[model samples]
Target chain A: MSFPKRIIKEAERIVSDPVPGIIAKPHEDNLRFFDVIIDGPEGSPFEGGHFKLELFLPEEYPMMAPKVRFLTKVYHPNIDKVGRICLDVLKNNWSPALQIRTVLLSIQSLLESPNPDDPLANDVAEAWKEDSSKAIATAKEWTNKYAK
Target chain B: MDSDISTGFTTDQSFDAFEDDGYDDLDTNSVVSVVAEEPLSYEVPYTSLSHEQLKQRFVSSVNQIQNLCGLSHEVAELLLIHNKFNIEWLGERYLDNPARTLQSIGLDLKYADYSFAPRLLPAPPNFLCAICCDDATYPVTFALPCGHRYCASCFKTYLRMRVSEGDIRLNCCLNSECRFPITDSVYKLLLSPSDYNRYRDQLIKLYVNCLPYLKWCIYPDCTYAVECKVNQADLDHIIPTVECNDGHKFCFGCSNEEHAPCICRLFAKWNKKCADDSETANWINVHTKGCPKCQATIEKNGGCNHMLCRKCGHEWCWVCSGPWSEHGTAYYNCSRYDEKSGQEARDQQAKSKASLERYLHYYNRYANHLESARLDKKLYLRTQKKMTDLQNSTSMTWIEVQYLANASDVLQHCRRTLMWTYAFAFYLERNNNTHIFENNQQDLELAVEKLSEMFERNTSELATKRLELLDMTSYVSTRRSLLLKDTQLGLLEGRWKYNLSN
Candidate 1:
C-alpha cells in the first residue's frame, strides 16, 4: 500500500460508486497505490479520451494532501505534459482540513474547468487560450493516440 | 404584539422619571415623610460630641447610627433634642427615640421596626450554581425562605467536600451579591409553601428562561455570536437581555440598532448582493459569447475556428485568437495619427470597427469566466466537505504515497524560465505599455522555445503520474478498510496482547 489508511479508505467508496467522468483501480503490487481514469468533461477539448491519474497517501496522512499526478499525455491548461498539477491543495495553500477524497474530486473539476489564466504548461495553455479549436484538436488527437 | 402598552415598566425599563421618586409616601400625614422628604445633603454644620456620650444615648453606639443613617461618620454630632429652639436648628428634634418616644404615644412599636436601623432580617434564601452563579449546577443546591433557588447536590457536597477539596464554608449561591447562608430560621421562611413556589417561578423566569444558545449570522460573512436567546426575541435589535459595561447594543433582526433598524430591509439588501454577483457573470456571455477573431461562440459557428481581426488589423484563429496570425487577403483602415492621408484615415475607421468587435467578444467571455469561477469555487468547497466525510466511512486509507519526482522537476525547471515567455506574449498581444515581448524580443523567443520543449517532453510522463494518483485514490479506501479491520482483529485475537507481555 503506497497510501495511508485514510486515503485508501476514501478511494474505496469513490471507486465502488464512481462519479460520471471519474474512474479508478489499484496499481500493481501496492493496494495503497492506485491508477485512476477520467474522461474529459463533455464540451471540453479533452472529451472522448480517457485520461489516466496517479494517487497515493503521504506518511502524514489526513493532515497533508495526497500525491496526485496526471497519467494521460494530453495537453491541458492546468497540467503540464509531464502530468504535474498546479492545484492549490498540492502546494503552498494546503490546509490540514483537506484530504484525498476532496483533492481528487477537485482535480476532476480542474479538468472540467481548466484555468488557462494560471497556466502550468505555458505553451499548451497559450495554444489552448489563443486558439481553443486547435487546442481541442490537439487534445482529442492525443487522447486517441495515447489514452486508448 | 398584543397590547402595545410600552410603559417601560414591563421590564427593567421605566416609563419615565416620575417613577422611583417619593411615590410610596404620597400622603404627607405619615411620620416617615418627615425624614424622607428632606435628605440632609451632608453640608450641615456639626457640634463636637464625645463618642462616649453619643454611645450612651444610642444604647449601642453613635458610630453605628452615623454610618447606618447616611450621616457623615467623620463629624461629631450635636445632641439638640434636649431643648429644641428653631425647627431647622435641631437635628435631634427630628430624631425620635423610637423606644421612648413611640412608647409615650401609646403606639406599641418595636424599636427594631420603628428605628429604621439596618437589622439582620431572616432574608429569604435561594440556591444557584456555585460556579456559574445564576446557572445552577445540579447536586450543589442550597435554598432560602423564598425557596426560590437551592444548590441541592452542591450544598451537600459543599458540606462533604469541605474538609479537603476547597473552602469549607459554603454561602448562598443566588447572585454573586447574595452571600448569606441559610440558617435554621431562614430555612423555615423557605419552607413556607406559597413563598417557595413563588421563588421557583422567579428562578425559572429570571435565570433559566433567559439563557444562551447557539447563534450564527445569516450573512455571507457568517460571524457567530453567543448571547441569551431571549435577547434575540426582538431580533431586529439584538437587545441583550442584560446590558454589558460598554453601552453597545444590537438588534438581531437587522443586526443594527437596539430597537429601531428594520431587519426586513437589511435582509433584502443582502439578497440583492447575491443576485447582482450572479447576473454579472451571466451578463458576460452576452458580450463575448463568440471567438474574438471569427465570432464563434460554440463549435457550430462556421467554416473553421479561424478568423482575422480586420479592425485592429491583427489576424488569428477565430476559436481563440492566438497570436500567430494566418496570412490572409483581409484588409482594414488604420487610424494611427492626428494628421494622415485620406486613405490612411479610412483604413483606421475600418480597422477600428473590426478590433472593437474582437475586443468586445474577448471581454465578454473573460468577464463571464470570472463570475462562474467564483460560483464554482463556492460550490466546490461545499461538495468537497461531503466527499471528505464519505472517504472516512468507506474504504479509504492514507498510508501509501506515490512520488511525482520526475514530472515535478521538469515543470519546475520550465517555471524558472516563463518570465521571458510572458514578455513575448505581452509584447505581441498589446500595442503599448502592455507589450512584453517587444521589450525583450530575443529573450522572449528563447524562453518560449525552452519552456515549450520542457512541456512537450514532460507531457507523457506527467500523464502517467496523473493516472497513478487517480487510481490510488479510487480504491485506496477499500483496501485500507480491510487492512485496518485485519489489524484490529489480530490485536483482539491475542497478537498484540500476547506480544505485549514479552
Candidate 2:
C-alpha cells in the first residue's frame, strides 16, 4: 500500500531537479506511477519531438528495474511498434544503484543513437541496415507525423 | 556358502574370454588381466562424488590456488571462479604475469591493498546510499575497493536478490562502469544464512558445469556428479555410460540413458526422427500420388484405374499415371508396363515404400525391446518377492535364492543392449562387418529371451531350477558383453560403415 523511501526520494528528486530535456511527474493517487516526457536529442533524426512514456515501479523496484514503455509512437530500430525499448540497462545489465533519472537519461541517449544491429523491430532494423539515409528520413517523417 | 553362490553367478571368466576374442590384435594378456581384475569393460571409468565430496574438492582447489599464487583465500576463490575452476590455466596466466591476469578478471592489482573481506564501518555524516536513497536508515555501511558505498541493509537486499537469481558472480561496486568482482566473503557477510547456502550450491553447480570432465546426474534430486576423463571427440566411438551413486545409469556424453552400442550422434538422430514429422511425410510418400496436372496429393480409396483430379479436373489412369485418353480401350485396366515414364514413377513409389518399410523394421524391433525391458524391470520387482517365497518354501537361504534376482538384472540389461542394437543397425550400411554385428545381436537377443522365459517359472520350480537359472544368467550376461565388446572394437577400428546422411 505504501512506497519505499527510495522510490519516494527518487520521485522527489526527479521532479525538483529534472534532467534538461526530460520531465517525470508521478501521479497524485499512485506515487509509484509516473508520466514521463523526453525531448528528442538535438542532431538526431528524432529531434524537436516530444515522446511520451509511462514508468511503473514494480513491487520489487530498486531490486528490479522499473517497467517503462513509450506512450507515443516513435520510429527507431530498437524501439518496437508496441513501445518496448531494447536497452541493456533496462534488463539484465540493470544495477540496483541506477535510479529513474539515470534510466531516463539512458533512454534519451538511446534515441540519439538507434542501434540497428540489436533491434527489437526486425523489419525496421533490416531497412536501417540496407539504407541508412532513407531510414533516417522515414524516422523523421514518423516523428513529425506521430510524435508531434 | 555366500562365496559359492557369488562365484556361481559371476560373469568375470566369460568377460575375460570376450576380451581375448574381441581384442586379439592387441596385447591379449594385458587385456585379459584387466578384464579378469575388473569386469567393467562396457562402462567408462568414472567416480561419483556426493555434495560434501565435491565441496571438499572445491575447498582443496581454492587452497591450492591460494598457496600457489600467494593470494588471500577470497581473492583466490574469485580467480578460480573467473577461470572456471581451471587451475592449470589460472596458474599459467598468474605465473606469466600476476597483475595482468588479476586485472583481466577485474580484480585490478591496484585494489589488492584493500581487504577483499567485507568490513562493517560507521556511515559517514549525511551519507546517502545511492542504491536505496536511504540517508539515515542504517548506521553501518559496506563498500568495495571502488568506494561506491551503500547502506548495509541495501547491500543485503541487493546481494540476496542476485543470489536468488542464481548469480554467484557479484560485482564489487554497484557503479555500472566498475567491473571489480565482489568476493565470496562479502556475499557471506551480507546475505542471510539460507541465501548464502543457496549461493554456495549455485557456485558448486557452476563449477561442475564449467569443467568438461564433470557432469551432474540428470535424474531429479540427484546431487551426485560423475567425473569422467572421456574426450568429447571420442563420443562418436565411446558411449561413456556411467552410473551415479544412486545407481542411475546414464551416458556421460549426452546425459541420456545408457545407450551402449549406439553412438550418441545416431541415438540423437533417431530420437529426433521419431519425434519429428519426417515419418508422417514418409507415410504420405508411400500412400499418396500427386496429380499429373495440378500436383495435388491424391490417395485412392476403392476407386477404378481411371481417375479424375478433383482440383484440376484432369483425367488420368491411376495404374500407369498416364492420360486417360491414352488408355482408350483399356478402360479400367492399364497395360503400359514397360513405358519409361510409367516405370520411373513406379520405381519412385517402390523406393519410398521400401524406405518406409526399412525404418519400420528397425523401429518395431527397437520399440519392442524398450517395452520388454520396462516389463522386465517390473518382473525384477516381482522376483524380489519370489526370492522371499523361495526362501520360506525351500531349504535355501536368501543368498542361495539370489540367482533369480541376478537373472532378472541380466535380462533387463541384455534387453536394453538389444534395443539399442536395432537403432545401431538401422544406420549401419550393408557390409560383411554388419553381418557379423547382426549375428552378435541375434545371439545376445536369443540368450536374453531364453533367460527371460526361464525366469518366469513358478517360485517352487525356481528353487529346483536355481543352477539352470544361474547358468542362463551368466550366459546371457556373457552374450551381452561379447556384443558390446565387438561393437566397441568395431567403432574403434572403423570396421562399421554408417548411412549417416539418412
Candidate 3:
C-alpha cells in the first residue's frame, strides 16, 4: 500500500503549486488513484465547463503510462460519452519522463482543441467536421446544462 | 536447371532498406538472384553442426562484424538482422553509407565515440532522475551516449521490465523526447551475469528469426539452425530437404518431417489425414462385417472364418456369413452366391465389402513399407559393422568398400519413397493414369524387395558381391525416382481424374 517516492513528491508539488484551471488530488483511501477536475480553456465552446477525470498509476508506473478517463460530461469529438480521451501521450506516445502535471495539462489543452480527426465520438466528430458553428452551439448548450 | 543466371543483388535488396528508411511505399519487385557463377564442388543440401559449433559461429560473426564496423556487437547485430544475416549485404550497405546505415538501425555513430571507452558518469551534486524523482546524488548514475542520465536502480528496473516482456529488442532511453536507443554496453553494465545471458539469448533469437536463410533445428530443445543456400524466392518451385546436425531430416519449404517425391502440400495433407481419427472410421466400415441373422456389427480379430454373433448366439461363415448349419454340411455351400437374399441387403453388403477390400489393400502396403523402412534403419547399423568386417578380412582399404555406405543410403531412400506411394495410392481411384502410377510403384517395390534380399544374403565373396550390391542399389534408386516423378507430375498437373461414380 506504500506509494513510491516519486508519486509522493508529485502529489506534494501539485498541492503546493496547482495549475490555474486544473485540480488533481489523490484520495485519502487510495494514494494511487487521483480525483481530477479540468476547467475548459477560455474562448472555446466548453469555456465555462467543469470536467472531472480519474487517473490511476499502474504497477509498472513510470515504465508504463497511467490509466486516465473522463468522469464528467463534455461535448467534444475527442472526448467520448464514456469519457475516454484520445490523446497520443496517454497511450503509445507516452514517455517515463512525463509526470502527472504534464498529463493534466495535456488533457486541459485537449479541451481547447478537440481534435475531430482523431475523434473518440464519431457522431460528434461528423457534426463538427460538417458544421462547426452548429456543433459549437450544441457544445456550449450542453456545457451550460450539465457542466455548469 | 533450364538456365543459370547471377547478378550482384545490391539494388534488389532496396525494399528492406526502404523499410529501415521508414518509407510507407512497398517495393514489390520479385528479384531473387542465386549466385552460381562458381559452381560448388559437391553440393550436399545439409551439413549438420553441433550446438557448440553453432554458438561459435554466432559469436565469431558477431565479433568480426563488431570489429569491421568499429561498432558495438549489438549495433552490428541490428545491421546483420536487417540484412537477413547476409554478411555481404551488410558489408555493402555499411561501405556505401556507414553513418546512414548505423542511424537506420537507431545507432548514432556520431555520438558513439568508440575511440574513448565509456566510463561511469560522475555523480553530480544534486541530480534527480525524472522517473523516480529521487535525489540520487550518492548512488551510481549511468549517462548514455545520448546524454540522458538516470540512477543505476531506475535504469535496471526499466531494463528488467522490458526484458521480461520480451520487448528488449530495441529499447530506448527513458527521456520523454530523446530518440536514442539503449545500447548493449548499457545492458552489459547494468544487468547481472544470468540476466545478461537471458538478454543475449533473446537478442540472438531476434536476429535468427529475421533471416530467411536460417531455420532452427526442429528437434526438441536443440539449438542449431539449418542454413540453406537458396533464398525464399528460389524455393517457389523447388522443395528443399534439410538434415539437421542432430540427424533430424525436414522439408525446409514447409518445416515438416522430410517427405521426398511427394510435394510439400500433399505431404502436409496426407500427414493430417493419417494423424486424425478418420482412419479408424474407415477401418470400421471396411473390416467389421455385420451379422446376417441379428444385424449386429462384428469385428473378427482372429484368422478363423467362422464368426459367432454373441448377441443372437448364431454361428456363421465369415465370408458369406451363412448359418453355421449350412456351412457344416459337407461341401460348405456358404462360399457360393445366394440369389435368395434381398437386393438392397446384397448391394449394401457388396459396397461395404468392396470399399473395405480397397482400404485393406492400400493400408497393408503402406504399413508394410513403413515397417520395412524402420527395420532398414537398424540394418544400417549392421551394414556399418559388415563394411568394417569386409575391410579387415579382405585386402581392400576402407575407401574401396565405401560402396556399402552408398548402397545403404539408396536403399533407405527407395524404402521411404515406397512408403509414401501407398499413401498416394489410397486417395487415388482406379484410373488410367493411376494404373500407370501403380505399375511404376510396383516396379520400384520389386526392385526394393530384390535389393533387400541381396543385402540379407551377405556372401563371403566381398569384391563381386559388393559390385552386385552397387548395381542393385542404382537400379532400385532409378525405379524409385521414376515412380516419384510420375506421382509429382500427376499432383502438379491436377490429374485427379478419379471417377465419382465409384
Candidate 4:
C-alpha cells in the first residue's frame, strides 16, 4: 500500500505550487485520492461559483489517465447529470506526460467555453444550440442553486 | 476411421479445387472431357499468399518506396503507411513537395539528424522527467526532436502500451504540444522483443486493410491473404469468390461465404430480409390469424367461435370464418360448406396470405438446401470411413475409392450453389430471362440430387458403382458451372431484372 515515487512527487508538487483558482487536497489515508475545488473563470457564466470535484489515480497512473468527476452538479453541455465530463484529454487524447494540474486546467477552460457541438448531455446541447442566451441563463441559475 | 477427414480432403485435390484450378489436369479423361468442352468463363483469377509470402510482399514494397524516395527505411515505411501503401501516389507527392509531404505525416525535414536514431543521453543536472515526476538527475534519458526529455524506462512503458494498442504511427514526444512523429528505430529501441513483433504485424495488417485489392481470409485463425484485382463496380456481374491457401472459400467482395450465381447486392438484401423475417414468420405461423374481413393481424388470446375485428368490427366465426349469423343455433358446431359468406371470407384471407406464402415459398427452398448441405457435410465425414471400408472389402486401391469422396464433394458444392440460387431467384423479377434461369436452376438441382443419392449408398455397393458415381460427379459439377456461367452472363448483359420494392 505504498505509492510510486512519481505519484508522491506529483502530489508534493500540486500542493506546493497549485494552479490558479484550483485547490487539491489528498485524503488522509489514501494518497492516490484527492478532493478538488475549482473557482469558475472570471468572464464565464459560472463565474464566482466554486465547483467541488473528486479525483482518483488508478493503478495504471501515469500510463493511464486519472478519473475525475464533479461532486457538485453543473448545467454545462459537456458535463452530464452523473458528473462525467466529456473532455478529450481525459479519454483518448490523454498522454502520460499530462499531469493532474493540466487536467484540472482543461476542465476549467471547458467551463469557460462550453462546447455544445461535442456535448455529452443531449438535451442541454440542444437547448444550447437553439438559444445560446437562454442556455447561459439556465447554466447561471444552476450554478447558483447547486454549485454555490 | 480418420477423425481428420475434413482437413484431409481439403488438403487433397478435391472436386472444388479441380473446379478452382479450371480443370487443368487431363489425367481423368472422362471428367476432363465433360468440363473441357465448355469455356470456363465463370472462374475468377486470384492468387493466395501465405503469411511468410505476405511479409515478403510488404518488405519488398517498403524497399521499393525506399529506393524511389531516397529516404531512410523508417521514413519510407512511415510514409507508405500514412499514404495507404500507394507507391505511385507517394512518389508523385514526394516528388512535388518533399518537405510538405514529410511535414504532413509529422516528420520534420531535420529529423534525419537525431530523431531517426534515438539514443540515451545524460540528463541535464537537476532535470525533472515531467511524466514520472522524477526530480533526481537520471543517468540516461530519451528525448525526441521536441526536447521533451523523459527517463528511458518511462519511454519504454509508453511505447509498449501504444504498440499493444495496435498503434503503428506514434508521436515522437509524449507532450501534446509537440507533433513530431516517432521513427521505427525509436520503437525498436524502446519496445520488448515480443511487443516489437506485434507492432510489425500490426503494421502489415494496416497495410492490408488500407489496400482494396488485398483482403485477409475471413476464416477464423486463417493467416492467408488473397490478392484480386477485381474492381468494386464488377461485383454486380462477378461474384469474386476466392479460396485461401487453407482452402477456405469466401467472396472477396463482401467477405461472406462463397455464394456464386448470387450477386453481392441481392445476396445482402436477401440475408437482411431473412434475418428480419425468420422469427416473425415463425411467430405468425403459430399464434396469429388475420381477420377475414379487414385483414388486421389478430392474435386470439382467449375467445369462442365469435370473433371481432378490433379495427373494423367485422364479426365472423373463429373456426370456419363464416358469418356468426350463419352459425345460427350451431353454437361452435357450425359445418358450413361453401356458403357464400364463408367463401367470401376465405377469398379475403387468401388475398392477404399470398405475399407471406410467396416469401415462405422461396425461404423454405433456401432453408431446405442449407439444411441438406449441412447434412451432406456430415455425410462427407462418413464418406471417409466408407472409402476406407471399400478399400479393405473390395479389390480397389486407395486412389480407386476416391470417386466416392469426389462425389460427396460435388454434392456439397452443388447443394451450396442451389441454396444461393433460391435467394437470387426470390429477388428476380418475372421475365423471359427468369424462366431460362429457373430452367437452369432445375437442371442443376436434379443433377445434384442424383449425385447426392448415389453418394449415400452403402460402402459395398460404392466399389461396384465407382464409374457411375464418377460420371455423375462430373455431370453435376458441369451443371453447376453452366448455371453459374449463364447467371454471370445474364448479370453482365443486364438481362435479369430485379423486383426491389419488397
Using TM-score as the measure, the top candidate is 2
The complex in candidate 1 yields a DockQ of 0.01
Model 2 interface CAPRI class: medium
Query: What does fnat come to for each candidate?
Result: 0.00, 0.72, 0.93, 0.76
- Local distance difference test, each candidate: 0.40, 0.82, 0.70, 0.81
Tell me the spans in candidate 3 whose CA falls farther than 4 Å from its real position.
A14-25, A35-54, A68-94, A101-148, B1-44, B49-75, B81-99, B105-109, B112-116, B135-137, B233-237, B268-419, B422-436, B443-502
Interface RMSD of 4: 1.2
Give one digit per residue, the lDDT tens place, for model 2 in B50-106.
Answer: 888789889999889988988888888888898889999998999899999888767
Chain B of candidate 3 vs. true chain B, TM: 0.63
Tens-place lDDT digits, model 3, residues A1-148: 7888888888888888999998999888777889998898999998988888899989888887888998878889988999898999897667788988899999889888888998899999999999999999999998998887
- TM-score for each of the candidates: 0.23, 0.90, 0.58, 0.87
Q: Residues A1-148, candidate 2, lDDT per residue (tens digit)?
A: 6777888899889999999999999998899999999999999999999999999998888888999999999989999999999999999888888889999999999999999999999999999999999999999998899888
Rank order (by TM-score, best first): 2, 4, 3, 1
Candidate 1, CAPRI quality class derived from DockQ: incorrect
Q: Give me the candidate number with maximum DockQ.
A: 2
Ten-residue segment with the worst summed lDDT in candidate 3 chain B?
B1-10
Q: Write model 1 residue lDDT over B226-338, tens digit each, in one string.
A: 23333334333222222111212233334442221112233334334334654344334433334444554433344543444444544444333343343243323122223
iRMS (Å) per candidate: 20.3, 1.2, 1.2, 1.2
lDDT of 2: 0.82
